[model samples]
Target: MRQSPNDLTPGGQQRRAAIIDAAAQLFNEHGYHQTSTAMIAERVGCAKATVYHYFRQKPEILFEIHDQWIEELSAHVADTSDDVPLSEFLRQVFRDILQLMETKSDHVRVFFEYYRELPDELRAVATSKRDHYERVIESRIRTGVDTGALRPQHPRIAAFALFGMCNWSYQWYRPGHELSDREIADELFEIYFAGVRAESPASP
Candidate 1:
């Protein structure tokens, strides 16, 4: 009988997390198609059947990685208070992403690079979650514009630009480098904010 992942005991949950982390690292290092269930099982120091016991198939594992990555990113903006200044709010959001990237670099890579590898149904779910996250950023940008905190611009395009800046950082960002994640985050926010902030009225 197949055991449900939801019914996992605490130890079982830890084992499952290990499997996912191992798979994320392997998938990040090797392309999704190149990686196999056996490889994942070996990385987890368990039998392939044990891997299957946790996840019915590789795509389920892939989807789990995608879910974890997106869920963490979503959490940064979830239930954000409007009272928070727009600049500080967005700055903190980017800061959080950089910090997460530092800690979960492997998962972050799989998220941006291997999303299409998910099966159609899983891909759709991931796409929906990803799109929702983008909308949250867009909503915040629109609010900034409406509130005169940001310049009048297409919120959707601006949102994409913001994502482009932070999302691509995983490609080059590394911890224990010249700049810490927070410093990099602040620099990115300043650069992004410079472009989007409401322009001052011309000298009268």
Candidate 2:
């Protein structure tokens, strides 16, 4: 019996997902400029045209993957409460980013590699989303400064430095190695906070 589109069985859904997954993996491994749609189709065991049916072009597929990843990251960061101390909040933020990178390594690779390839309009959109994430860190730094928890410094610069430290981890962080994500987060936080935290209050 011929099945309608709505009647696709579990196997069909799995196959579709497999195609997307394969494309994402290949794009990450080889970079967008290097990976061809034909390669993606071959990896997915589908015709090149079929790959087009799912994604109009390589850039569209890359955008889709990036969109999904940023959405999830935004949600994770949004869930953090304002009540938490700055240090704890920063810890959670780092942990969330590390966990996402560890689990979605391919997406992370594609995100970093293809960011500049996006059109100006799309680049603006992507940057806006990223800036939203950065604002959270910036706000925390500002709060710490206001409360005298951290040394007085330019919040924006401090925030950028913290983000740079965390974001660059994708370059060298390897999964299944000795250091767990939590350990990496802890070490990173230690290095960052030790430098930024205010010195012991002058003896009263």
Candidate 3:
């Protein structure tokens, strides 16, 4: 389990949060290797030691960034109830993921780029959470297929295809572009679930 960093005083906790926030943006903008601790400190307007005071190493920050996200996301996925109709549950799951990525696009980018940069031990922890994420989505897809709510297909392929639609949003999705996140997710989910072909025959 990742340490909460809650043992620190309120001020200390705030500083640590600020450091992670700055580091994620820098790491995402300038590749983790290109971004240095000094740049992180400069961005946060704190001394280099202060940065070190909160985190012993840059990898810890990367780990923390991933930790913060996966912990919350995992919790959300866990909370998804299987009691609902399979179709309803699936829509809820993707919308929840879209909301998360929209709210923390920078963190999403950092995780996408620097997840492998974490210490082996920390990467293992993150990897487990990712696996859990996959399992939850995969299970939902299988259930949908079994219930006739979805087309017959490989569950793992369907699961990752859904994941791809949400995960890739960090790359080009922006606020107030032509479409809202919900709008894009709605259309993407419609395509993934229903396919591109017209539902009715053409009236030629």
Candidate 4:
């Protein structure tokens, strides 16, 4: 029987992870436009054929990286129950995304840089996963509006704006510097909610 990917031996798994890590860093630093499979293999101390054994092409490696990122973000969002209050849930969601961005900064950077180079089919899959994440945020914003915790407005628009605010942080966020991720999330939440929530239930 053919072994599943998860059935790989420990050393095999470690080698695969190392290759992915090296590829992601190269793609991030040099961009997919400038990076090559040979560079990836060199960085990982593996034969070029070894990298090909795992990924058919450089773009395929990028697709895998993006797929893994989406899967992880989806899992995190899925674990958050709707039973939580909207405000708190939003807080959790923001913090979780920020943490993901921080942990996968290199991958995220490469994703944004090379996403356009993915084949049409792969791009569709990636776009759908991205849309799903946006929908999750929009759903929570809609819930907040329904519960009187947020102002009544277009949920999709609010979700997009909110996502943009948080996603753009990847461009400027620095680790172990001035602000912690939690502190940044808290400040952003306060600014976002204060402007969006209805005041006194009486304002025109």
Query: Best by TM-score, which number?
Result: 1
RMSD vs true structure, all candidates: 3.0, 4.9, 4.5, 3.1
CA error at residue 139 for candidate 4, angstroms: 1.1
Q: What tens digits encode model 2's per-residue C-alpha lDDT throughout 25-55?
A: 9977787788898999899888998776656
Candidate models: Cα lDDT each: 0.87, 0.78, 0.79, 0.80
The residue ranges of model 3 lying beyond 4 angstroms of the native Cα positions read 1-3, 196-204
Better of 1 and 3 by TM-score: 1
Q: Is candidate 1 or candidate 2 better by TM-score?
A: 1
Q: Which candidate do you rate higher for TM-score, 1 or 4?
A: 1
lDDT digits (tens) for residues 1-204 of candidate 1: 145567889899899999999999999888888999999999999999989888888888888887887888888789677777788888988898899888888988887888887889999999999999999889988888877778889999999998899999999998889999999999999999899988862210
Q: For candidate 3, report its TM-score.
A: 0.87
Ordering by lDDT: 1, 4, 3, 2
Per residue, candidate 4 scores C-alpha lDDT tens digits across 40-69 of 999999899888777777777888788888
Question: Candidate 1, after superposition: displacement of residue 62 in Å?
Answer: 1.1
- By summed lDDT, the worst window of 10 consecutive residues in model 4 runs over 195-204
Cα displacement (Å) at residue 135, model 4 = 0.9
Q: What's the TM-score of each model vs. the native? A: 0.93, 0.84, 0.87, 0.91
Checking candidate 2 for backbone clashes, the offending pairs are none
